[model samples]
Target: MTTDPRTLIWSKSSYSGNGGSCVEWAPAQTTTGIVPVRDSKNPDGPVLSVPTRSFAEFIAGVKSGAFFAA
Candidate 1:
């Protein structure tokens, strides 16, 4: 089933802090095993739909600082 991006609720992490560089995701999308992600600064921009498992791995990487530069 196709879902409308505008109809889904998007939210960012609390750790996003004061920076406007955060991304938002629609938890409601998880019902279909798809995670919808989009830039908070560009709500009208393109949306990325990632598999639920892939999204979870990405989050794990973020928590582990795998993407951080030494």
Candidate 2:
């Protein structure tokens, strides 16, 4: 499914408080089962379209700290 990133509303994580390192996602566009993600610092940058289930798994991993160094 092709989507115009400019038409999507992006929202950043609340946990990103005062951090320059932040990412944004378009929940509105996720209705089609595709999650659009982009750097909050670079709105005009490239956008990544990930499957809804895959994005959910990725979020779970983050909450589980699976991405942190062991």
Best by lDDT: 2
lDDT of 1 by residue, 1-70 (tens): 2888889899996656576567899998898999999888788889999999999999999999889745
Displacement of the residue 45 alpha carbon in candidate 1, Å = 0.7
Question: How many steric clashes between backbone atoms does each model show?
Answer: 0, 0
Candidate 1: deviation at residue 68, Å?
0.5
TM-score versus the correct structure, for each prediction: 0.86, 0.86
Worst ten in a row by lDDT for model 1 = 13-22
Candidate 2 lands at a TM-score of 0.86
Tens-place lDDT per residue, model 2, 1-70, is: 4988988888997657675678899998888999999898889999999999999999999999889744
Model 2 misplaced regions, further than 4 Å: none
